[model samples]
Each structure stands twice: as structure tokens, then as C-alpha cells.
Target: MYECAVLSVYVDLALGLAVTFLLLSLLVSGLNEAFVRLLSIRSKFLWAYLRDTLDGADDRTGAWLPAGVLDVFRVLPFLRDPRPRHSDRPAPAQPSAVPDPGERAGDSMINLLYERVREIDHGKRGRTSISDIPPARFAVAVMELVTAGGDVDDFLTRLRQIDSPLYGPLKGVWESAQRDLDRFTKGVETWFDGEMQRLSTLYKRYVTWVVAVLGVVVTLLFSMDGLEYAKTLLRDNAYRASVTAVAEAGPEAYAELRARCAGQEPVACVTETLSQPALVGMLDQALVSLSIPDQGAPSVHWNGGRWWDRVTTPAHWPGFLLTYVALLFGAPFWWDVLRRITGIKAKR
Candidate 1:
């Protein structure tokens, strides 16, 4: 009975992930197209508008006003992180907070002018240059992305072996980023906004939601054995074998019917139940059994969800893995913030 309850939880989590994955898979192709459209207008317009509004000193350089405007904020260093013995992690500094947006132009102009002098003297040394042509940075970013092969292990392994002069500077920048990120997390612990005089439950929704997610994580961690049980049961049960068989067989019978789903109607039908990958995979397996190998170009990598089976499933079991990974990420950030704000000295 105890094991049954645990199995139920495993079932629910798998179901939840399956539901999320299915919906994502169904909408993914359309979402990709929508994203392309969104970027076409918003990305460029936002940049140009921000640039023009922030800097108007005859347009010799890009926006200076924005930098100056940022300086107007009554921001203070809520946390003092340990300065790295040798890293260019900018010492976190505070600026005055902006109470209103109306005085931005006049206030920002002077601030920008002041910042211009400081930057001219203290800009990052290894900054990449840009010309009218598309910057090589994007190419480099793509190379990094592609060479990593979408795996963390491969990315880190290759990073250590990189012998290029270009890589040495990037390595330093990466280390500094790690330091800054550590400080940011540390600052968050005691960080308070002028807007919130007291940290009410309502004011701490971000922290609260994170805690709730942690509860979900704890539940999953305790259910790991149950998850393995579910997989094993699914593999061995002859009653479940019928379900898998139906999914694997008789593709032509369902394929024509599914094809008639003009829009996302077929996938959308199970939008509440199936995650994209499970539904898509189930459908595809049935189709192939009916001797219909799909010639359709695969969906976006993020959406298709097949990559999970190919990549993650091979390395580890399925069901809500990245969710835990994300929480792991947030843990460090929150811990750092707390440490900085509370001035918790780390044990050596």
C-alpha cells in the first residue's frame, strides 16, 4: 500500500511532464514561426527606441542617456560579495533610484556625460568590435553552441582543452561571470526594495514560489525508486502490453483520421493529456508499424521532445529531470543572495 501510493506519485509526475511535453510539441512549430515574427518587430524597435531616447548628443556614438539614466536610480549595494583575488568581476556599485520617468532626459544627459569619461578610462580590455556587417560574436556563439552538441559534459570537456589565445581571454571572462553571478545571488538574501518597506508574504511571492517548487522537488527525490518501479512495471505488465501494442500497431486506421485534423486538432485533442513527445512518438510508432515512415521534416529541437529519448534517456531516466536541474541552479543563486545580505561567512 505504501509502495502503491509512491507509484501513484510517480504516475502523476510522469503524467504532468507528459502533459507539458505534449502541449509544447503540438504548439512548437507554430511557436517557432511566432517567435520569428515577434523578433522581426519587437527586437529591432525596442533597441532603436531605447538607443534614440537615451542618447541624443548628435548621435556620434550609441545611447549614452540610458547609462546615465541607470545611474540615477537610488540603488545601493545590498550585499558585499567576496572580491575574487584576481578577477574582473565589476565591484557591484550602487546608484540613486529614479522616482519618476519625466525627468529622465535632463537627469540622464549629465549622468551619461559623466559615465562617458569613466568608460573611456575603465572599459573592458578584451571587448569584441562590431562593424556594419553581422558581428563575428554571433558566429562564435553559434560555434560554441554547435560544438557543445547540446550536452553540458561535452561543452565543459571541450572548454578545458581549448588552447587558442582567444579562448584564454574568454575563460577569464567566464570566471568573472561566475563570480558576479555568485555575488548577485548573495545580494538577493537580504535585498529589499524601497518599494516594499516590510517583506510581507505577498511581497515575497518570488521566494514563496521557489519554496513551493522545492516541495515539489523533495517529493520527486523521495519518489525515485517508485519511478523506476513504474518503468519496470510498464515494461513487464502484459495488461499494459495491450496498450503499447495498440499504439505500435494499426497506424493506417488512425493515420487517415489524424490526417484529417486540419489544424492542430489531432494533437490538440490530447493537449490536456499527452505531452508532445509521447503523443508524437506513439503516433509515429503506430504509423511506422502500418508501413508509413513519416517524411515530414522534424520539428524544432526544443519542441520535438524525441531528443529526450535520444540524449537524456540514454544517460539518465526520464520524467522531470531538468526541473530539478533548474532548482539546483536557483539554490546557488538564493544561497548567495542570502549569504551576502546576511553577511554569512563561509566556512573555510
Candidate 2:
């Protein structure tokens, strides 16, 4: 019977992850097509122009995949040019150090880079290298609109007021353009240097965050799922309480959760179960609270403000997590980790 419960849990999770991964694969396949069509799109604004880079048409996705999962497809060896060489002449005197800075003095290397990529190949596959897609191109597209008719003042004025994440990065670049077109060209080199450093730092931060998140996700996938099944079993109580309640209880349950978040109930006095986020948060809080043994996997419980800790031993959390991880994803996880750690590529 114990084994049967575990098996049933595995079946549910396999079905779920399989469906999710399949959908992800299909979505990526669609993106492969969309990226090609987008190159023709042009706009005075950089944001609109940035949209043109994608080969796919449909990007409306409600499901958010983690950066790590997305990175696999993003950093695929065959997709991008490893040795990214700029198409434009080298920047005069100093080079634009950004990933693909152009040779132009006052002009955005990003713009020239775009010109070169299109020059290299527009519609044909195996024509232009994929690494040509850099953030500078997006920045330059916006700059083109600003620099039209050589009006720098209006552009800077409007740019400062606009709300955007890129605004900060592009500020120094534009300021360089305004101050010295020749000296500003020198400034462009500086700007590229800064941007490259910024991006590199951001990428490192992203890597650390992604790894920690994967650890947490892997932990939950193995350990808390069984506990989730147990909670589902407990919800059978609400189902038994009243047939009518069962129909209405979902909204009611949410309302009860909101009330708890508002601190209407004392910590120990609450009777209703927490929402998923709150439950996950509680498990994290518990790891710190109880001084529980730390393991590669994290554990969670849905406490209805009662002492459920006695039922689920602190020690069992790691075991359950490991068992689930090993049973469900051990092989694939090990393979991926080995490949990533060793920088080894799998042959196609």
C-alpha cells in the first residue's frame, strides 16, 4: 500500500511534467519559425524594432519557464555564431567594446552591426550568424528615431521622461552623443565598455539565482509532492463536510487565506489551510525556524495552523525528496548536470 501511494504520486507528476515539457518543446519549435518572419519589421522606436528580431509570430505566453530551462535552447551550440565578428569596419581609433559594436565614430555600433547582419543575410538561413542579435541594435533603432534631422535635444528630453529599464544603460551613450560627436565617438567606446561589464555581471547574477532556484525546485519536486498528495487526501474532509461547500469552498478557501494574510487570525488560531505560495513560504520559514538538518532538497507541509510537524518527521523530508527525485528525474538531472559542469556537449 505504501509503495502504491508512492507509485500513484509518481504517475501524476510524470504526466504533469511530460505535458509541460512537451508543450515547451512545441512552443520552441514555433519560435524557430517566428524569428525568421520578424526581421522585415521596422519601426522608429527601438522596442518595436526589437520585436523584429524574433523568427516567430506568437509570443503570448502565460506560462513562465525559468531562465535555466530557457537557457538550454537559448545557448544551443548550433543556433548561434560562437566567434561573433562585426560586419562594420572597426570603430575609428577605439573599438566599440559592446558584444558587436560598429566601426562608426558617432553612429551606434549596434546600428552598423544591424546593417552588417542584414547585409550578410536577411531571409536565408545559414546566411547571417545568430550571435548578431545584440542589445546595441535595439538601442540604435531608438537612437535613429532620436537623431532624425540631427535633432538631439528633443530626443534626450523625451528619453529622460520615459519609463524603461534600458533608459539607465543608454543614458551615458546618448550623453556622449550629445557632448562630442568626435569626442562622443570616444565616449561610445566607454559606453560599450560599461555595457559589457554590466551585462556580464547581470549574467553571473542570473546564473547564481538560477542554480539556487533549480535546487529549490528540484527539492520541492521530490519531497513536497508526496506531502501535496497527503494534503489532497486531507481536503477530502472539506469534501465530506458539505457537498455544497465543496462547490463553493475554493473561493471561500481563498478568502480565508486573504484573511490570514491580513493578520486577522492569530498565528496559532487559524483553521484553514494556506495557499500554495504561503505554504511554500512556510516551509522555507520552517527550515530556518526549527534548525532542521539541511540537505540538497527542501521540504514543505501545509499546516492548518496546527502542529503537523509531529506527523511528518523533519528527517523524512530529505529522504522523501531524494526518493522522488531519483525515481522521477535522477537520470536526466544527472546527465544535464554532468554536461553543464564538465562543459561536455552531447553529439547530435
TM-score of each candidate?
A: 0.20, 0.26
RMSD of each: 22.0, 21.0
**Which 10-residue span in candidate 1 carries the lowest summed lDDT?**
75-84
Please provide, for model 2 over 64-176, each residue's C-alpha lDDT reduced to its tens digit, 9 standing for 90 to 100: 11125354234322232222233443323322222211221322333433453343333333333332334454345444544542444554443344322234545665575
Q: List the candidate 2 regions with Cα displacement exceeding 4 Å.
A: 1-135, 157-214, 223-348
lDDT of each model, Cα atoms only?
0.33, 0.39
Question: Residue-wise lDDT of candidate 1 within 268-293, one digit each (tens)?
Answer: 54342233333333323211212222
Backbone clashes for every candidate come to: 17, 11
N/CA/C clash count, model 2 = 11
